[model samples]
Target: MIWYSHVNEDSLPEIVCSTGYNSVIAVAGSGERLIALLDNANLEQLFVVDTNMSAIELLKLKLVALSELDVEDYLRFIGAEEMSSRERMRCFIKLQNKLESSTIIYWSKNHHFIKKGILYIGQYEQFLSKARPLLKWFLGPSFMKVFNNDYNSFSKFRWKIVKSVFSKKVSYLLLGNKDPAFIGKGVDTSLITNGFQELIDKKEFHKSFMAHLVFLGSLKQMDIEFLPASQNRKILKKIQAKLKNREIKIQFINNDALSFLEDNTSTTFNFNVFLSMSDILSFHKTDYVIKCIKALKVSNKCKCAFVFRSYLRNHIDTDIIKKITALGYKIKDVSNMESTKMYKVHLVEKL
Candidate 1:
């Protein structure tokens, strides 16, 4: 499996917000961003494609949870908060019968992942788990305080500290030097190295926060985008309502993006928007991406949006734009208005 079981997107919902598209094609990383988009917009159909079986199963589990469990139970189950193995088994059993036999059989062998909670299995989550302690040791308890309270005034000084902590040397040692066998497929080490460097340069360390933080000497608390404990219940409730009403149809296909596009010969489904979350540009070849674009049956006003990590914007954006343009699309750079400045967004419209 390339991506374990975690959500990798932060700005997809913000990009897709209020675009009332009838259909959407998205990558199912953690499925959180896709669900967020669903909650934010009314869609008739959603096609989520991923190459990893584990990721596909994880999405299925989340859908079952949303469809069956209430907000509190869903939160507890995913958050892994005080939920025992027996409790997890009970929840899984309930979810299992609700899912297809293939899904149940696939998950039954991976009960260990279920016990720990699928949300916590992502490679990005694992990285954050290891990096958080190191960050705390280096920045101390007041680290987030400087950003939240007086970031503008102290940004320069704090940036220096960030640079020292996340320098190129450290990033290369930790991410770039990983064993190829241990590293999942389609994971580019160079991109990871560049991503860390970009974060330091942008002084956007808050993007990586995996939990809520109670800053020192302040009653105010901040929630991270990756896993906001407070928002889980509301998002789940919205998804459940949509599911119950039969307002949305979400299909998960366990195949690479290019293969998924090529395999589907049916011209019945035409998507108005394609949300590419940097995986295609970062991992797959440009030729394959062009093929995928050619295979997709999009509307005349179809807009294909791509979100790239800061580091990749300079390296890959031009090539991607050129390729998409060659296939008869006009390019629009919407990165300036994006709330999460950590990523660069580009929209390609049919000419």
Candidate 2:
């Protein structure tokens, strides 16, 4: 399994909300983040790329659900609420005809996740399920209070409680070690620990949605925007409107990021923008980053946006920026961006 089943990236959608792009190449995690981007923009072509077949299958299931089900039913289906197993099965059956054979076979092989609901299958979601109870037990009722309150006013006692719960010992037991051979391969523990500590130290907990998710399991109590709501109806309405007049293409490719970029060098796929949620730089080396940037056949106005975890801002960001600049791209000032204070947002444009 991949290091992350789903990475909650609220900032990507916000960053590209107004930019009109004809084509987009995005990393597919839980598929929710990409869907959020799609909800805000209408593109001529969308390529959802990922190395994990399971991740691709998950994205396909989501696409089918969005196409077939209404917003409410789609929410219910993914949320696993107000629907029985049989009803869910019926929903899947209805969608199967509308999906490709490959998708159908993949879903059939992982029918358990389908019957149980797709949202519950990710490694991150499963980890949260186990950690939530522990968090509640350790923090007690005060957890909800602190989570809901203002971060600036978060008492010292609250910080102490958070620090105690997120200690090295607890993190090791909860998140496990950073061994690539493990099930959750190639994760940077500092991305979680040091990142959280930085947020708390800076008193930016209120702005750190990822931290909230790691500690509290949900952002509902955070009293701020976290993940966007499932905009199924909105997307479906747009799709229907488009189908009545023209054709729209959305493709999903199951390949590693480096290989996908490398193989696309000869294609005329004029991707106007690329959005990644810090996975490539965090997991892979600088050489792979250079290859990805080199392989992309982007337009002159193309902008590449990446959200890097705070811990990676020093070395990784410097190396990537140097390579991208060497390739003739100019770095755009990302200081004005909001909702991404927890991360170092990098935006570069092809010169």
Q: Largest lDDT belongs to which candidate?
A: 2
RMSD to native for every prediction? 5.2, 4.3
Would you give me the overall lDDT of model 1?
0.57
Off by over 4 Å in 2: 2-7, 13-18, 40-42, 80-82, 150-161, 164-212, 215-247, 268-278, 299-315, 333-342
Question: Each candidate's lDDT (Cα)?
Answer: 0.57, 0.59
Residue-pair clashes per prediction, in order, are 0, 0
For candidate 2, lDDT tens digit of each residue in 1-351? 533434455545333632566566777777776665554444666777887777777777776786678756775676534567677888889888888898899888876777766766676667667766776676566544545544544355755666665544446455643323122334334444555666556666655567656666544444424444443355546654443344557788888866777787787454556545444454565466566667777555445543332223232456667878899876554534534343445565566
If scored against the real structure, what TM-score would every candidate get? 0.76, 0.78
Clashing pairs in 2: none
Span of ten consecutive residues with least summed lDDT in model 1? 211-220
Query: Residue by residue across 18-85, what tens digits does model 1's lDDT show?
Result: 27556677777667666676764547787888887777777778777877888767766765345776
